[model samples]
Target: MEPNNDFEIFLVATPGLEAPLHAEAVEQGFADTKPVPGGVTCRGSWPEVWRANLCLRGANKVLVRLGGFPAVHLAQLDKRARKFPWAEFLRPDVPVKVEATSRKSRIYHAGAARQRIEVAITETLGAPVSSDAAVRVLLRIEKDLCTFSIDSSGEPLHKRGHKPAVAKAPMRETMAAMFLRECGFDGSEPVLDPMCGSGTFVIEAAEIALGLRPGRSRSFAFENLPSFDPNAWSSMRQQQPLAKPDVVFHGSDRNSGAIEASTKNADRAGVADFTMFQTRSVSDIKPPSDAAGLVIVNPPYGARIGDEKRLRSVYGSLGKVLQTKFKGWRIGIVTSNAGLARSTRLPLLPPGPIVDHGGTKIRLYQTGVLT
Candidate 1:
């Protein structure tokens, strides 16, 4: 498929992690990074889109703008929707879903607006629209302007198509990746997640070290688009060499169920060979090897476990364990409760920006040397 030069790609991030996302985007060689309300906007081609999806650790999803038009009323919306070149991107056999959101616009009725869009697309391109469609076309009407885009990613990028099970309050894969990046992990050194509930940190670390594409195991909505070229996709897929890491990646959880879940998830992510999961508590945790490494933990917050006091003790024990056991290793802790995190008295620097995980605002606290 020919690349669309006029389109813009937006990397949507968690609420307070826009700066990190912007930095990561620029580090990954994006031409420009514009900090927006909830994310960063970067200009790139289809290859860049693929790279962003693979390399970006903080972005929730990458959206490509297909078309836009100013519409103050319903008639203009209908007329402009009809003018969009839907046939260029969508296939008639692939069912499409229309989702609409409005802000400060005359078309306040989202249902009516979606109906107008569906009618316009079906009438103009002979494409079928269903509520349960696999592909989604998002419509945004803000300040009398309507923006249209097809969701390049069907399932949210966090799914990664690898993890089939989750523990209580599982950390998102994207957030886990970003947190690891923030801790200065580059896949060259060992990474230990002492409280790795579902092995997100370890798996993401292994993927980064080995240059594995996070999207390799997952299917995208764009794959079903009319413009999708199987030859190009196959070439791209074949070009990525499998990454094998020699360093140790370790994760431990108190619950045997969590350890089992992490093992299965790592296996699905194709990083099982690089990772080691064990059933152990934080108090019993030790560095993977005598060598210094990055230690990241996403322990239970009070909200999920319903006992802030008990979790505080757990955090205190973790801090003591880190201070006495792993002296030179860097420590990263993700939590929603600042008080609970403060219990880990390791002379921690100010926590990084907050991120939304399952509706809770959580922050990352880093301590020790980031070697």
Candidate 2:
């Protein structure tokens, strides 16, 4: 487990968005990337793991596969865990937490497996184990093979360490970044979200256009690892000059409070100079510039059964506005209800794959440039 040796690195994707996450990894030059069920896997050492945490906007978390072995039983697992080279990667001064998941294996009890590893780390490496430790070790036992990994991103990457204000049912920044990519956004065009709640889409678009690293404002769990090199990580985090897009990103909401929140968030993200938020209803929304760009909105799709019938008019109104004023601009609407999306009558292409958003299943309904 030397610092310079290549190991398996996993970038956890938002459930149902593995393809886009994998595409992002490849675009960012991560080597040997392959999309699996829950995430994308690649080969990288500690520096690559650190760069993934700092640069990739769509990754929910970056994990380093330390090593693994086969253990058919609990006693074997404990014996093997104690022999692991923990000191090579983990800091004895920093507390650690171990989480284990077992599937289709002889060691079926995940709790018992977790306990064995926790005891091994404390006793062998002299590192304290706590439930609330910022650094986490993940163990997965499947088909009698046990694999160990470290969570290099402490908090979820969606946190972004900024955005203190949020609105109801707000979009996660990671999801927003992927959705933007899915819409064919490449940081060269304006983006407008008419029903923007706390301005997640607008802020993300502005950051992309400005070439800002998503993790620039935050610290990461990899910083606590024994393999972490301060000088190398610092050089990796150094910023280039921000690009100034010709068009500015725009967001609007009928809720004045949401507008205030969006303004505050953009300021904190260092993209206020490139973004605009206003208190305006869907019908009042217009193209921010004469140039056509993207109109992506995450409108309210009611949770209750009868709410769709009531929201049809709202969707219809949005559709009518875009048809009349936003011709040639692309549109993407995110909602959980298919009927509500149909209500827009915006000639949407087939819906995207179902995406999990805070337990609700949603999809992206998009169209080519509005005709």
Best by lDDT: 2
Query: Which lDDT value does model 2 have at 332?
Result: 97
Across 84-202, the per-residue lDDT of candidate 1 in tens digits comes to 88888788788889999999998898888999999998998888999888789999999988888777777778878778978877788887877888888888899999888888899
Which segments of candidate 1 are over 4 A away from where they belong? 1-3
Please list all clashing residue pairs in model 1, or write none if there are none. Answer: none
Indicate which candidate wins on TM-score: 2
Give the count of colliding residue pairs in each prediction.
0, 0
